[model samples]
Target: MTTIARVETFLVAPRWLFVRVETDDGIVGWGEATCEGRSETVRTAVEQLSELLIGRDALRIEDHWQVLTKASFYRGGPILASAVSGLDQALWDIAGKRYGAPVHQLLGGPVRDRIRVYGWVGGDEPDEVRDQIAGRVEAGLTAVKMNASGRMSPLASVAELDAVVRRVAAAREVLGEHRDVAVDFHGRFTLANARRVAPLLEPYRPLFLEEPVVPENSHLIGELVRATTTPVSTGERLYSRQEFLPVLQAGIAVAQPDLAHAGGITEVRKIAALAEVYDVQLAPHCPLGPIALAACLQVGFATPNYLIQEQSIGIHYNLGAEVLDYCVDQQPLSFVDGYVQRLTAPGLGIEIDEQAVRAADKRGHAWRSPTFRHPDGAYAEW
Candidate 1:
């Protein structure tokens, strides 16, 4: 038996943690469990998980998932789920390599040869929305996503409300009729503000209004979705199928599952299956690293209702490093008119540059996501 021999983690630059798993016969697999702004915390969780994984058979992936997840009295959250998710991806990587096929092939073969992907534009909030949209358009991208606001107050004045509408209008000007633009609310809006803003942006026809309210307030999603002609999308914060079921029932037009935090390939595949029944589109939320993007591609290739993918090639969050920086063969992530070609190599397809990863780990980061505050010294969702 090819027992799991070693599990290692490299905390790479620009906020990502790469997981490398090896077997007795020298077969290696890689996965990403990056909980951006919390890489070190997830790293510690992975270290603890390694104790449970070290002597197991690398091929019994499902069994390992069942044990690593359910064996614990408390299971499912960003930390534990993110830890298991990376290992799940690595195990699937090993299985694909063992079978000499792509991960999608092992998941019942490819449903589409290539999947369309959307590029991210703007910083925490868009400063030069038109210029940024133009840049993506010039880069041969047909679709792009941008934050609706940097830090939105519970209710805003006319100036703030007008600015939000203007940002969406600016993107529409760059995209025109053929291309698409998705506006991400980032859960920065209160139900009142979201209700007011969703209607204003309808004339521009955004691909979807993402997370008008946070996942915790998901019971209110249908209110936002029903209020707008534009679609509503969510799920990067959601960790499992159960967390997603109620959201799916809320009439969301699209579902965005992050492969690294949502139970990796094992649970996300089931989540995708559930989304299909509701006629909701799939757009895996991957703003982390290469492995997460590759896993998203694997699911995107096999799933029929997949809408598009979000890759962090040059996303604003990448402070000092880019997604392709860790890829051995960067061509797999090359965009062809905004669409990533289907990966064909065994395992997760793209190779990780371990040397670069280890060197970056030497200068590890303590990345923290930005915090938001109201003028009155109260905490606000970021």
Candidate 2:
């Protein structure tokens, strides 16, 4: 019997926390537990949770999840969920490696041969929107997602509203009808602002309007959905199925749970199942590293309600380090005609370069999400 021997966490560059689990039989599995700006907090949580798994059965993934999430009375938040997510992924990886199959195969086999993916274009304060969209088009990508606006006002001025439309219009013009473009509000708009902007974007026909308002204002999401012809998508900040239920019930067309933040493979699969019941499609939100992306793809392959994937191959946030930097073979992550073919390798299906990871951890970073404020010094969503 293979019992768990060690659990470790690494703080990788450009804001990612990776968890490594090794069994007594020497089988190893990797998972990403990144919470973006809160990597250090999540790292500590990972260490605390590791105490529960050190001498347990490696194959008891579900039982471990129950303890890691429920053992503590104070439960369910980004930090704890992120920690469990990473460990959960590593355990599933170990299970797949032990069974000599991919994680998706263990999740009840593949429902699709390949999954379509989208790339990020434009930064927080978007400029050169057309050029970036053109680059993605030239790269043979079929879909692209860009910010709708940056540092928007509570009640947007005419100029602010016009700028949002212009960015989406440029993207639609470049993408044409053959390709798709998704506009992410990045939780930067007020409900009123989102309501006003959503109608203006209808002529351009965006694939979806993401996070039109912050997760806290989710109750208003149904109103926004009712006001717009465009599909409404959200859930990057939401960490569990309970948080997602109201948004799903509120009429979100897509559910964008981050695999690293949403309780890893174990919880996210349940979230996907829950979303399926509401007729909403699953598009796991992933803007971190290879391990997280690999985990997201594993779930995507087996999820029947899967829509498209959001990848950070060239996203603006990746500074000094990129997704493929720690990967031993980049082929599993490489995009071909806008879709990644089903991963056939064992475990999470990609080999992480341990040496590279170790070296990066030595020069660990403190990446904080940029703070934004209004002209009068009031706090603004980043």
Candidate 3:
């Protein structure tokens, strides 16, 4: 029996919160639970959740997850779900380590030899979009994703519409007919404006259009799904399985659950299974740090319906620390021709550089998405 000896949490660089679980036999497993704009809060939440885990049998991940999620009177939010998510990932890592197998093996088995991935290219201009796609291609990425529209309102200007179309067009031209380019709406546009802009980018044949409208407007998701030939992908904002039911029922072709926010391995795996039944493709959203990426990879390896993964290796927000900065073995995440070979190592596969994590922890971040104001002084989504 593997008794949990200690549960430790680290708030580390760029923007990530990691939870490490130590077993009595000295085997350790890692999980990532950082929310993009709230790493500190989630780190604090993991500390509080640690009380429920320490000294328990490390192999009983599902049992611990039940208590962590249900035993507490309060439940279901980014902070708590993310806390559980990280712990669950670490526990799975521990299980795989204990059994001398990869985490994917425990989930069932590998569905593909490798997983395809997409990189981010920020900014709203055609030139920036062009340069970003070229960088990703140069880096050997087969797919790239960028923000579709910027700071839009109820009615966007002709220039804003043109800017969005031009950016998509530029990426398509550079990518030519071989690679795929995904456009993320980022829930930044009003429904009416989103409807107007959707068709404009459609001609360029985006790989997919993500979150054209907010998740709350998911009923309208079906509307957009029916409106375009491009696949509609969403779910990072969705917190639980119930939240995903409607979106899946909305007939969304792609499901984008963020491993950090969507209840870790325990919940996201269940979510992936649920999506599988709907005949929808799974593409876990991960723009945080390495632990999150490792967690995403573990699930991606076992998920049969997985599509391309979104990673933040060279994303714009990674101004301070890059993905491989905290890992001992960065080669597992290394890509060739746009695909990451299956992560077959025990637990989460890659090893964390503890010393590096501790040193970067000292500079801990206090990050908040930039504030944007609408033309009318109202708050705008950032």
The candidate maximizing TM-score is 2
Model 2 TM-score on a 0 to 1 scale = 0.98
Give per-residue lDDT, candidate 2, residue 151.
94
Ten contiguous residues with the weakest lDDT in model 3: 7-16
Show the lowest summed lDDT stretch of 10 residues, model 2: 122-131
Clashes of each: 0, 0, 1
> Which 10 residues in a row give candidate 1 its minimum summed lDDT?
123-132
RMSD of 2: 1.1
Ranking by TM-score: 2, 1, 3
lDDT tens digits by residue: candidate 2, 1-382: 7799998889989899999999999999999999989999999999999999999998999999999999998999999999999999999999999999999999999999999999999843334888888888888799999989889899999999998988888888788888999999999999999999899999998889999988888989999999998999999989999999999999999999999999999999999999999999998899889999999999999999999998999777799899999999999999999999999999999999999999999999999989999999999998
Candidate 2 vs 3: which has more TM-score: 2
Error of 1 at 308 (Å): 0.3
Of 2 and 3, the candidate ahead on lDDT is 2
**TM-scores, each model vs. reference:** 0.98, 0.98, 0.97
Error of 3 at 347 (Å): 0.9
| Candidate 3 lDDT over residue span 1-382, tens digit each | 8998888888776778888889999998888888878878888888888888888899888899889999888899889989888989899889998998888989898888898998989867888888888989999999999998778876899988888888899999999999998889898887787778888877888888899888778878888877777888999999789899998998889999888888888898889889999999998899888888888888888888888898988887787889999989889999999999998788888888988987887887777778888888998877
Model 1 scores a C-alpha lDDT of 0.89
TM-score, cand. 1 vs. native: 0.98
Residue 302's lDDT in candidate 1: 87
Model 1: per-residue lDDT, tens digit, 179-296?
A: 9999898988998899999899999999999888988898898888788788999999999989999989989989998999999999999999999999999999988899999999
Question: Which residue ranges in model 2 land beyond 4 Å of their true spot?
Answer: 123-127
Q: Assess the local accuracy of residue 166 in candidate 1 as a C-alpha lDDT between 0 and 100.
A: 85
